[model samples]
Target: MRLIPNMISSLPSSLLRRAAFVVLIFGGLAACQKNDASAGQVTGTLNDAAQAAGQKLDQAASYVGQQVDATKATAQQNLDSASAPSINIDPAALASSAQANLQNAASTANAQLGKAASITGQGLEAAGRKLQAWSAQNATSSASSSASSSGSSSASADSSDAQKQMDK
Candidate 1:
């Protein structure tokens, strides 16, 4: 401390004023440099936050794309299932079965018609025989009744003639 005072006392007033001015300028420059460093740190933090936001957006976009792809695939699968082809139809066999059924039905109907015709023929023959027998019976009964009536009428005539003779 004694040396510092002795050096100050020996320095000229003009030189001391120049040295103080130099120290003040250096201190101001250091403060400005510190402020610049803080600004650089703030800028770096903002850049980091922006990068994080960009990354999140990218992730969201990727997730949406995946969902779209999944939905599209499911729709395609549903369409495929709906439009699936049937492989069990056999046209030739179906036609043959139908023809066979028709033939059987036609044969059954023909047989039934023939039976009906035979029964009808038998019924007509029986009716004709019955009618002939009934007609013959009626004819015989009418002939006998007419003969009896004629005989009675002749007897009545003879009685009337005898009565007339007696009266006379």
Candidate 2:
């Protein structure tokens, strides 16, 4: 009572006026009608929106699960098919074909080796003939240049022996 008035008197007049203004504004706001119906409508709308979102999420999850199951089934089917034998092979026929190819290769190699041997033999024979002719020519020349007939005869005999040995 007296204490409150004494406190108010101790405050500045400008501070008192500001306090009164704040109190009047708050009191006026409190006297206004609050629309409870709109609040309830907003709350209901929020709940409905939340329920719709939840339903959409559930549907999306179901669709994804279905797609995953379908994919798994397709993969399993592919795996099963892959495990089954698709190509037929006959071991006996394959062995017979390989044996024939080996026989043909062996015959071809033998023919080629025989031809090479024949060509080598002919070349060796021709080289031996040429060496013998050259040796005979050298022996004749040396015998003719010797001082004695005996030495020439001996050299001719040696050349003939060498030629005979080469022929054999």
Candidate 3:
């Protein structure tokens, strides 16, 4: 009779305790899931500093460009003021020097040609003497051969007559 009411009251209290525990556990898990923004904040600040440094670098490049233009203009002015030296050559002297060199070369060539001609003449005389000696040698050998052939035929005729008289 009293057990039913007491059991129903205890049920509500138990449900309430479980809901509170679930809420605490979900809150802990949610806290773990959330991202830490401190590192991102630091990196964002560094990116901004880098962009600022790039702007300064661009300004410095502009200053360098202006200085380069100034240097170029000054160099052009110096080139305009400076002059190259001019020289005038004497035509007669140039021609006489060239003529003297040509005369020396021609004399050297003429002397060499005369020496070569003298050597060629000596070579021709020696070759002529050698050819005449060879011709004389050949003529003497041919005359001796003809005389020996005539003597050999006469001896053969005398031997044949002596043999016929013996046979008779």
- The numbered model that scores best in lDDT is 2
In model 1, where is the ten-residue run with the lowest total lDDT? 29-38
Point out the higher-scoring one by lDDT: 2 or 3.
Answer: 2
Q: Candidate 1's error at 37, in angstroms?
A: 99
Q: Which tens-of-lDDT digit does each residue in 1-168 have in candidate 1?
A: 123223223333333353344335433433332121234553553354334434433443344344344434544454455465854534455344434443443344344334433443344344335534554455445545655777866555645553343333
Q: Rank the candidates by TM-score, best first.
A: 2, 3, 1
TM-score of model 1 vs. true structure: 0.36
Which candidate achieves the best TM-score against the true structure? Answer: 2
lDDT of candidate 2?
A: 0.44
Clashes of each: 0, 0, 0
Q: Which sections of candidate 2 miss by over 4 Å?
A: 1-84, 147-168
Q: For candidate 3, lDDT tens digit of each residue in 38-155?
A: 4454355334433443343344334434434443454344344433346454545544443443344334434433443344334434433553454445444544565477786655
Q: In model 3, where do residues sit more than 4 Å from their true spots?
A: 1-88, 151-168
Q: TM-scores of the models, in the given order?
A: 0.36, 0.39, 0.37
In candidate 1, residue 121 scores what lDDT? 39
Model 2: per-residue Cα lDDT over 1-168, one tens digit each = 123224223333333353345334433432342322234543553354334434433443344344344434544454455466994545455344434443443344344334433443344344335545665676556555552556757767766764564344
Candidate with more favorable, higher TM-score: 2 or 3: 2
Measured with C-alpha atoms, the lDDT of residue 134 in candidate 3 is 49
- Could you tell me how far off, in angstroms, the CA of residue 45 lies in candidate 1 after the best superposition? 99
